[model samples]
Target: MLIRINQDAHPIAPSEITPESLYRGRRNFIRAAGLGAAALAVSPAFAAAKLGAIQKSPLSSTEAPTALKSVISYNNFYEFGTGKEDPARNAGRFKTRPWTVRVDGLCAKPRTFAIDDLLKLAPLEERIYRMRCVEGWSMVIPWNGFPLASLLKQVEPLGSAKFVEFVTAADRATMPGLALPVLDWPYTEGLRIDEAMHPLTILALGLYGEELLAQNGAPLRLVVPWKYGFKGAKSLVSIRLTDKQPATAWNIAAPNEYGFYSNVNPEVDHPRWSQASERRIGEFTKRKTLPFNGYADHVARLYAGMDLRKFY
Candidate 1:
């Protein structure tokens, strides 16, 4: 007799799929996922297949996402707005079946990619990292996805391509967040070429080992762990590599409040709040914010010549 493998049982997050052999798990894990308990549930044996439970860095324990924290608090689908539970409550209206990413500007091979095409390019890996938010909150997200740099490299940046700009999906009906003039409805963000290539930055499709939900910017979103949460724009619909710095949504909202860099610097406080302390979401919001979101050593060099305060 052959055991029937259920797809949802072994439903690993899109980015975590490749880090381990998804098919190698006990068939029971797959059955469990399909039992209506949850979708994309993984077996205990496969949990450690990626980065596992070890904190990516000592500074980020509170910030690093864990198995428990990953599911309970994650999925930043802001289409429904800023409510923490909005995504889970209101994101179902989003239609993600025919998603596509249009890539253009300063590249030899400009093309549109189906969501699946991008998923297949890189095997998913779960990375536990500090996620600093401008709202003085942070989380240790066990993010699953290949580095964003991997995808940017495919289009091949030209000599003048200095920035990477991402545009969000434009559907105001489902995404009530777009209804407000909060940074031009369809959100957008940009990173300097060097920052875009940072190893820690990720174009994530899911969190906590499952496909991203609609309110969580389903289909695709960026996770730049070192920057303020808003810096990692969501609901990406287009990517453009430009010679000039594109006007980012948050930066445009309040230039003084948000800088182009938007790096998580406790020393440089947001105009509205102290960046010194962040509520690591599930961790009671009293956690101290780490410099560079605990990736300063890996990302500090990118800002070598200039003062972060001035640039930010």
Candidate 2:
């Protein structure tokens, strides 16, 4: 089934349908009540199989997408649990509604935007991106959202802004895993000012042509295609622009394992495992990893002259 919203209201469309073995080859996740008014505003089959104004980005991968089940059921959202399947099982009860994101720190205008208001800030686009996890696994996902820079521009960052920090929520009532001291509470991630403002960086609001499921960081999340998957913090509650580099969850927990840059480099091996190759989610055999997760051409210049090994 296809879903759509009114373009005048800024619709978030899905990518073109691929082989059933590729993307959107799973159960429909969005219900009538999930989108509420947005779903009601347009025809039932609005923008069938099209991503509306959200165009297919050139940087997206052409490879077949990982199964939706694998994408949702297997993840590293510690807010739900440490196990791979923990998020899918435990995140169902997590409350994503009534969500808001506070944009503050070194910016000319700092304000809190409710999810609905945020959606109206700019038109949503569909971007298919490759997500490589620090655990050496990977997947290609189609995300629905707008460029994060657009939102940042609205607030107008000051000259002092050098870094962008993303902080997640830690409510035990919604997120049971918060009870555990795993990786510290309120997960955080960061990006350099230039990196954060890059067109490749986006705020993901949905996937597979539907509203995002809680297990997948519903409401709002970050998607930095060139960086490791963990670098994109889920369930984002706040965005802070600061003059100094901000602390990230993994970097704080185990500086030796994860780094501030966390760029996808085959040459830099994880302390416990090799990052030279990774297993595609649905495939058995592993594939050679690429520099900057195969986005080196578009992003390599950003890190030119810097020792990636030392910085990462």
By summed lDDT, which 10 consecutive residues of candidate 2 come out lowest? 40-49
lDDT, candidate 1, 115-195, per-residue tens: 878777676766777766677766666666778888888888788899999998878777776676656657789999888
Off by over 4 Å in 1: 1-78
Per-residue accuracy of model 2 over 205-292 as CA lDDT, tens digit each? 8777666677778778999989999998998999999989999999999999999999999999999999999988877789999999
TM-score of 2: 0.84
Error of 1 at 189 (Å): 0.3
Model 2 clashes, total count: 0
